[model samples]
Target: MVRSAYERGVTTLTLDSPHNRNALSKGLVAGLRAGLAQAAADDAVRAVLLTHTGNTFCAGADLREGSGSPAELAALLRSIVELPKPVVARVEGHVRAGGTGLLGACDISVAGPGASFAFTEARIGVAPAVISMPLLPRLDARAAARYYLTGERFGAAEAARIGLVTLAAEEGADGGTGASGKGVDALLEPVLDGLRRGSPQGLAESKRLVTAEVLRTFDRDTDSLAELSARLFASDEAREGMTAFLERREPAWVP
Candidate 1:
């Protein structure tokens, strides 16, 4: 479900599974890992741009698909963190639950005005356990606690303010105008150009320096978090929560 394109030393990995809002189905995750692997092997590739094909960047785990293993999710997040080349995210729509993990893994992220983010796992009776490995190290403590606990939805600007995203592009304006006038693409042009300008070794080494702590967090916590996630997803509360979400109603616990 991931589509790949190469241009000017950048390999763009587009999440193509719009049917499930690019939910992290086994296929989608495998495809994304494969795309990243290819980019890593290609000397001509300077960076990776992660994007989506629909209005929602990703809706989180494929609750409908049976892969429900948080371990796989951890692996996917780690792959991005360990990737030798920088990974930049282009978020023009909504991101939820584990999708935010993908955003957190990227070296840099650009979110358009239309983008929204939420840690909706709590609503489903599960915590954002696996994702926390990548996110907590970067996000502000107070902001993370609020959103993660309440499952509140926030806009691109709020996401940027909390360090979840690097840039939140302004709303509609000519693409030619500077940051204020340009949308996501315009804001991304310079970032992409900067990546293109960096020598391969320089970019790789620089990325390593920035991502070291993220990798350390992954090494220290991945197993326990994955276990916690799996346990929650299997609990009765989570089952009811998932059913309620699929049925478009509040779970019974919602008073």
Candidate 2:
């Protein structure tokens, strides 16, 4: 479900689904798109904080329902990257697979010490295709390549070190307060303060310019990347690997 609240000119949108750890289902994606569109159109909303309910921020896509059609995932990712307002992700727990993609797509991210991250798509026999679009921009090239290939779990500190997260909070610090209503409020105050101090028009214009530059860069190189991902996903190896994982057996691809 999508929940929105406005305070001190900051609009906060939350993905509230404790069950399934707030997984991004098709419905959730639609809710997010609508909420973000509202935020963009509302003049009173100067900034947006995207957070989630439950212990974990999000566990990624609802795989039990099957992997989303490629077109749907691609559209969701595009909306996130093109969101007009500055979107800050307040991560409170482990963010894995598609969860990390959402965090990376945001303008800024503050994660709690307890919040670990991983790109586990390879383990599940899926390509981190759309996720790679955002993650590559947020992380160092070598770091992105390594994590995407290895699917290793890393801590918030390591994420920050690799430039995946901008800020890492200590236990009682900003993001570590947990995902309570009050905690989210406390964490978002400072971000709103900073945005309130800036020129709204300037912020919007700068974001647009930067997005244009980034898209231009991606357009020049994404054809090959997309083809590779599609091929990988369609291969026998990926099917075998995913089935092995679901069956709790060693993948044939693994030594």
Candidate 3:
């Protein structure tokens, strides 16, 4: 579920699926892709704000949904990568796995002080797949390799230090101030105001320049992340993990 609103040429998109911790489901991802596409095509939209509901910004892909057919997941990720407009991720809470991928794809990201990030795919016995392409650019190769391999959770400060987050908040400040719960509104206000003040053409151009560099740096090495993803989805480990999760039991893979 997503809500979109335009004000003073800025489009704000909110994820509204609090029930599943806003895990990215196929329909939700489709809506997001379509919304971003529309914003890219609309001259009136200068910048975009991406935020979510609940304490967690996004939990990740809905593993309950068959790991989403690989073809669909690749298409969705590609749409995010190719979106021409400047998109900012407003991270107010935890973001893990696929959620981290979405943030990595954004042009800019501002996070609340309390926000935490993780790449937990390996814990469940699967690779990050297409998500790794985007994430690798957001972080140093060593850091990316370490986290991707270990599935370790990191806090907001560490996230910022590692370049995964651009701004970190302190306590008691505006909701946008980078302070846990309080600084988000403040942080967004100035950023949104600045966005409104800038020329849309310049903004678009800047986005293109930066994105080009990122693209060059993190271009998908293999032709088909989806093909690899399909193999992983059907792997014995993934099958067992998914079934165990659905059945509300610990995976046997755990020692």
Worst 10-residue lDDT window for candidate 3 reads 173-182
**Span of 10 residues, lowest total lDDT, candidate 1:** 170-179
Give the per-residue lDDT digits (tens) of candidate 1, residues 1-255.
Answer: 999999999999999998899999999999999999999999999999999997999999998973277898999999999999999999999999999999999999999888899999999898999999999999999999999999999988899999999998755455333357767888899999999999999998999999999999999999999999989998999999999999999999999
What does candidate 2's lDDT look like per residue over 1-255, in tens digits?
A: 879998877788898977778877887888888888898898887778888787788787776555655555556666766777778888878788878878867777887767888888888687677667767766898988898899899886688789888776645445444334334346556776888776778778767776674455356645655566567666777777667766889888677
TM-score of 2: 0.84
TM-score of predicted structure 1: 0.96
Per-model TM-score, in order, reads 0.96, 0.84, 0.88
Instruction: Please give the CA lDDT of all the candidate structures.
Output: 0.92, 0.74, 0.77
**Candidate number with the higher TM-score (1 or 2):** 1
Quote the positional error of residue 225 for candidate 3 in Å: 1.8
Task: Arrange candidates, best TM-score first.
Answer: 1, 3, 2
The local lDDT score (0 to 100) that residue 5 gets in candidate 3 is: 92
Off by over 4 Å in 2: 171-188, 217-235, 247-249
lDDT of prediction 3: 0.77
Write down the worst ten-residue block by lDDT for model 2: 175-184
Question: Cα miss at 191, model 2 (Å)?
Answer: 2.5
